[model samples]
Target: MRHAETVTFGGSALNRAAELRGDKADVLALNENSRSIALWRGKPLICGTNLDQLALLPVSQDLFSEADEPPVPPIFLGQSEDGSALFAHDISAWEPAALDTAAMQQFVDPTQQHHPALPDDHRFVELRGVMAQLSARDAELAATARSIFGWHRSHRFCSNCGAESRMAMSGWQRNCPTCKTSHFPRTDPVVIMLITRGNKVLMGRSPGWPDGMYSLLAGFVEPGETLEAAVRREVYEEAGIRVGAVSYLSSQPWPFPSSLMFGCAGEALNEDITVDPHEIEDALWISREDMLTVFSGQHPTMKPSRKGAIAHFLLRNWLADRLD
Candidate 1:
C-alpha cells in the first residue's frame, strides 16, 4: 500500500537519541529548549478549533504554568529536521478527571469539550478521536508521548525487589534503588487478522462496542508464539474458524497503553463460525459488497472499524486490492 507508512503513529522517524538519554546535563538542556512539546494527561497541547489535528506547543508556552504538580520526567522523543530536540513532558498529575460511566469507552473525542482550565488558545484533546486528521508526524509524536508516560505511570515500583523505582535514561528506563534492577518500557504484541474466504472477510465485535461496530479478529500474541501462529490461533479461538495461509500486511503503533498491532491477511479453510462466548460476543462473515457499504456508512447493520486504526487501514487497502 502506498500509504502504509502514512498510518497513524508509525511514519515519522523521531531519531530517538539514546546516548543523550543518560547524559543529565544534555537532557536537561534539551528540556529547556523552546521547541519541546508538552503533553498534558493523554492530550497534546493543540492550537485553535482544529480538534481533528494536533498543533504542538512550544516548551515556553504559558500552558506549563498550570502544571503545578510534579509530572513524570519528560521523555526524549527524538530530533526534528533542523537538529532541534523533541521532548514529551507529562502533566497528567495536573489534569484531574471526573470519571463517570461514560468514561468506560476505550476511545474518547474531547474535541467537543472546552477545557476550562486550559488557555483559550489551546485545548488538550484525545488523540484516538483525532488521529485520522493528524499529520503523520503529529500522530507519531503524540503516540510516543502517551506510550512513554503510560509506562512510567504503571511501573512506578520495581517488580524484582518491591522497591520504588526512579525514572532514568530520560524516561526510557526505571531503576530500582534496592536491587539496582532496570526495567524498560514494554510494547505488547497483538495480531489483528483480516481473515478471508472467497469474497467475504470475517469480523467480530466485543460485547460493549457501539451498535453495528465490528472489527478484524484480534488477540495478544502469547509467549512462544510467532505472528503467523498468533493469527491462526486467534481466529480459531475467537471465531472457531480454521485458517490456513497467513501473511503479513502492515503494522500500526497503538498507544492505548502501548501495544504494537500487527495486521495480517489470512486465508480461511472453513466457513462455519462457532463463536466463542469467552472471546467474542458475535462473529460473522461479511461479503466484499457489504463491506463497501459499511465503509461508506450505508450498511444497515454493520459499521466499519474506527478510522486511523490498523483494522480500518487494512480493510481499506484490502477493498482497493492494494494490500501487498
Candidate 2:
C-alpha cells in the first residue's frame, strides 16, 4: 500500500483553498490572475498535439458568457503555481453542428468537441479516454470538475424540502432558501476486491459488457456497511464466493459518475464458482500466469481491463508483488 497514492488520479496534492470558499472578496481579488478550465458535457478541454495538456482559459474570456452554468459561478478548483487561482466552468450549452449523441453515450466515448471561439488545438476530450496520459494535477482538476458538475446537474432540487437550491460556497455546496438547508457533493463509496485463492484470481463480467471484458468484483457500500463487510457481501452476492481476511490495499477516485473506489485484497475461502445471473453474467478463476497473458494482450479469450482504472492498477501490482 506504500505506492497506493501513486495510482492514476491519486497523487495530486492540489491545494483546494477551502478557507477562501466563504471569503467573497478574497476570491474575487484572486481573479486578477485566475484562469479557468472548461468542461463540455463532462469532458475536459485538453490541448497539445498529444492531448496531454489541460487547457487553462483566461478568467475573463468571452466564452464564459456562453457557458450554461450562469447563476452558478465557476467552481474554484484550487490554488495554482504562484498566487493564481484555478477554476472550472461548464460550457455544455453550446451545441456542436454535428454532435454524435451515440458516441457520447458509449461506455467509453472517444468523441472530442472543439469550440469555434477557442484555438484549433484546444478540444474537449472525454476524461477517461485520456486520463492515463494526463499529469497528476491535470487529472485531479478534470475529475473534480466532472464529479461536482454532475452532482449539481442531478441534484438541483433540495432533498429536505423539494425546493430548488442555488449553488453556494463557490460550487462546493448548494443552499435551498425555502428550507434553509445546505447540501454538499456526494461521493458513493465502492469496494473493488482483488480476491485470490492460491495462484489464481477471481474475475467476472457483467451482462452487456463487451466480449472478453472481465474485471475484479466490485460493489457499492450500502448504508451502515463497513468496507470489509461490503467486500464480503458483494463477492458472495455476485459470484457466490466467500472472502476471508479482507485488508485495504489502495484507493482511487473514480469520477465516471462520482465514486471513490476502495481497493482491497481478500482471500477467497472457496474456489467453486456460482455466479448470480442478477449480479453478473459469468465468473471464473484465472491463474496468475494467465493474468499476465491478459495484461500483455496475448490472452486468447479475455481482454485487458482499462489501464487507468483501479482494477488494472491492483491487478498489475499484485502480479509484481507490490501491494505492500
Find the candidate with the highest TM-score and give its number: 2
Clashing pairs in 2: 1-324
Cα RMSD of all models vs. native, in order, equals: 2.5, 1.4
lDDT of 1 by residue, 1-324 (tens): 566786778877777767667685244544555365666666776655666456555655554545655534567777778767777766655634543336634546444333465567666667777788887888888888889888888889999989999998877889998999999999999999999999999999998888888999999999999999999999999999999999888889999989999988999999999998999899999999999999999998887789999999889888999987
lDDT of 2 at 205: 94
Predicted structure with the largest lDDT when compared to the true one:
2
Clashes of 2: 1
As a whole number from 0 to 100, the lDDT of residue 257 in candidate 1 is: 81
Instruction: Summarize candidate 2's per-residue lDDT along 68-112 as a digit string, tens digits.
Output: 545247898888768588888888887887988897888788898
**TM-score of predicted model 2?**
0.97
226 in model 1: Cα distance from truth in Å?
Answer: 0.8
The C-alpha local distance difference test score for the whole of candidate 2 amounts to 0.90
